[model samples]
Target: MTGDQGTGALAVLELLAQEAPAARIEALLHEARRAGAADAELAELARAVELARTVQASAYRGRDREAALAALVDTAHDLTSPYDLDSLLRVIARRARRLLTFDMAYVSLRRTDGTSYVRTSEGDTTALNAGRELGEGPSLGSLAEERRAPVWSADYLDDDSVPHRPGIDAVVRAEGLRAIIAVPLRSGDTTLGALYGADRKVRHFTPDEIGVLLSLADLAALAIQQAALLERTREEVTELERFGSVTNTTLTRVRHLWDCHTRLARMVLDGARLSTLARAAADALDGVLQVRDPGGRPLTAADELPDLDEEAVTRAALQAHTGRSPVPLPGDVWVAPVTAGAEDLGVLVLRASAALTDEDVRLLELAAQSVAALLLIQRGTAAAEGPVRDELLQDLLDRPHHADLHVRERTRRLGIDLDVPHVVVVARPEGGELGKAVAWSSSYAYRCGGLKAVRRGCIVLLLPGSDASAVARKVSAELSPLLGHPVSTGAAGPARGAAGVAGVYEEAGRCLDALTALDGAGGTASLRELGFLGLLLSTDHDVDAFIASTIGPVLEYDETRMTDLTRTLDAYYESGGSPTHAAEALHVHPNTVSRRLERIAELLGEAWQKPAQALEIQMALRLRKARAALRAHRTP
Candidate 1:
């Protein structure tokens, strides 16, 4: 070729780059003909022009692909912003139509059936939304799956080369759809679904257009996966927050429980009153709390609630005792057995005005425990206060003359006033456990501020009282059931000083012996109840007082019956216990004397003829006569 042909070829390339019309190409070919060119030269120049045009068009297409690639990058960024599968799909569909010059767009996620249906649609009005059901019929999605590549159709109704589904064909015919392309939406080896672009007019799809749609589908699939992960993360965060809230509430409740129990423990340690402790616990439990003795007597109360329902409290207490814990009543009340092992100290009762929970019951039980500890301490002190009290009482009773400053200080320390008017009581259990009897006696003595000593099968007590007989009766009444038998008790008192105590103890022993011989010591008695014999044993020895007590019944009977009962009784004892001889002295028959003696026995008691009663009667008769003579002489 010549320089002219080379230069013309270069001009054709420039014109093609500028995208000159076909008229300019023909005019250039004519100018080559006018250049006196040979047919071969002209034809060669024409061929060069065509080759340059092809090269220029190829270069321009490459630049267009570059722009498409840059737009796909921006689309990928926009797809990430959607943050949800549905929204990301919509963005993908919209960007696909705008980037690829389609009139409508839509998206379909692949179902498990391996078929495609329109999830989102744009750019086409069509009933051909169902691409294919692979098992049922051949579809675009199935075809893509089979080929592992994109599928496209120009004039889909007329095209027989591509796979067609009848349902898809019917819808395409109704909507007049022609050109169609579907790209597989893929992430790694998994094919999610297909993205489709279609037009109503038959048109061929360029490779660049198909590439653009495939890139968008890839970005959308990644965005959809990311959205699913983000949704899962949000759910996990919500669950964690809810769990943390529950844990925080549990921790707070535990802290409150610890504080309440700690306060209760401190109250017990500080020796607070039962009422004070109950009040604190009631505040914590939001209820009316009470501490009761084993007998249901209220020891302390936290509120002015209704009067105690003793029956209900007792039933609940029994239930609690059986369980060895707290129990609920018919009402909103609960009770806890206040006990130390098998020994039931008392009960803690609570009447709740608000809802009562297991935690509140736990607080009630703790209060009961505190109350049990206090009661046990008290019982420990009263039942047996070590050996101090027993030893001091035994020393005083055995050797009273040895009383010294130490005894005085010990008595004072033990809350005893030895110098005060006091009584001496001696008791023996009739038939029972001796250990239990002694325990009962010791506890009773301590409660009354007295000292007790057990010596030689006898419980001896020196208590602060002037009435010996009353003290003896109290001991018997209080100890009979506890010791499981009758208590034979005797007392003597109104004594003072160690010497007086010792003397009264002897007198009290004699009284006990006298009662034992007469009544077998099945009951209580004292010198004051015994009569002239008691006067003989007593230090005071008031003869007139003894006479009045010993034969007062006979004297009063004689006065009421208008008979010589006292004189006949004196005559009878004067005749050496012979009713016949006494009748001779009294100017009456033996039968008459016997009748009067029988009446005397009726007035006194059936045992009036026993040795002790007989001796007392004789002494009263002699003392009465002596007192009568003395009064007669003094009056004259």
Candidate 2:
């Protein structure tokens, strides 16, 4: 072609790229003819236009194919959830109609006799459209099924090459469908059903459009198989339920077991405690409940179970770790192993008048499984966080002054506020059951929004509180039972911020030492609780502060009223707390000394003469005298 003709064709191609109107293209053709373009050049330009149109149509077809693939993928994802067959088939039919622009669409399932009946129909106006049955013959739906491929006809009524079945042909005539397609819904080599789409115009189905129809059929087959399995399962469950309700004895047993299962499942869902499960099992089995860890120590239970044969319980519980069911023990106790898959968590021990029946044992086992699931969840959560908590707590207690902003952020994520008042509690359980003590204390600390760590041989916790002694006693009381031995706790704090924890921990350690030295092991105490020993053993010896605190009121009363109450108090203590003897020591009348003692009681508390208070008072008096005598000896 000439350069001018090539240029004209190039202009037409550019217009096509811009998607110019038909009128604009026609005007351009007239100008080309008026410009004395040769008939051959014009014909070449026509061929270019036809080729451009074909390429443009092909691109549009490719875009449609991409959209169809995406839609089918999304539909497959949506089918991941459960669905009934009728609902799923309707969905498939509706999708087929929309994607292929079919005037009508329907799904048909093949019967055992090789006949197919419409299961679902969409966008159809006929009443017989859905229930329309296609007889067993070499027809549209069966042809696709036998060949395991898609079958289509441009005009079903006029297409003589395609063998048509009377029943299917009758429905097509009534629906006025001219073009129709069918694809087999296959599961492996077995065809379960067929999906059909039809239009009222004589139009040929494209290969890509046929593929889209096949995709919908695949989705329909998956839905059918899933729904079949679902229906079979429901039938089995219904049969069992029906059989159970037939007789009173069997019915009661089944109902009781089912109730137990439901309650336990609900407990796991709602995050109920192990103790709650123990109580539920005990009630269901009519036995006393005693839940024990693998090592034979008793855990918390809903009901207080009596002391049983500990050796038998431990032996049977351990045997249950590998056994399939609850292991029978002496003294009418059954131990059901609690496990998370292959990992043994613990055991549920039941004590009753006699060992439970097989069904009741199963009930107890169900409870054990529930307990296992809950423990596994707890263990998994702790496995991630417990180490971090322990490390942070150890660091905070050991090097509290070094806790910087990063440490603060870590603490914040853990829901711990470092700026608040906190205490350090130390516990040392007897029998060296460190593991049991640590476990119990860790749970206690978490609930209090505090941190726990094992330092030395003791379980230490940094807790939120001001009452150190109270915290100590609570820990000792609660942990002793879990450890199956006595636990002594010592605490010191109400310390604010990370910088104060170290000093408080040291003080708490000394308090523990003082308690043990006083033969108060297995008891709880704080520095102040130790009284004189606390004062002497204190790292920061505030003797003057102690003296002022102990006898400040009496000293102040003496200075303000110019009274000899101090000397009276001194003589009273020197005379063995006897006022008549103190009178002679003070060289005053007994009445006057008695009156001064009463005044002293008013300045101090009413419990001034009490043993604990009297000891503190006498200690302060002696310390004051020692300081004065030392000062006098140093004077020049």
Winner by TM-score: 2
Off by over 4 Å in 2: 1-380, 516-520, 542-571, 583-613, 621-636
Q: What Cα-based lDDT does every candidate model obtain?
A: 0.73, 0.76
Q: Model 1: which ten-residue window has the lowest total lDDT?
A: 377-386
Q: Which tens-of-lDDT digit does each residue in 1-636 have in candidate 1?
A: 778777777777778768786578767888878778777778877897677667566556655665675576567557535256777777888888888887666676777666556676665564455343334567766677556478988777888898887767776777677888877766545677777777888889976677567656755665565466456645754676777753666556545765676576556545465678889988888888888766666667997658767787888899898898898876688889986546666788888887677556766776676566444333334432435577677778778777478678767766788788889888988986778777666756765778888767888888888889998887777677555678888789878876677788888888888888887667777877876558878877777667777899998887788999898889988898899999999999999999999998888889887888888888888888988898889954
Which candidate leads the pack in lDDT?
Answer: 2
The residue pairs that clash in candidate 2, if any, are none
Cα-based TM-score, every candidate: 0.39, 0.42
TM-score of 2: 0.42
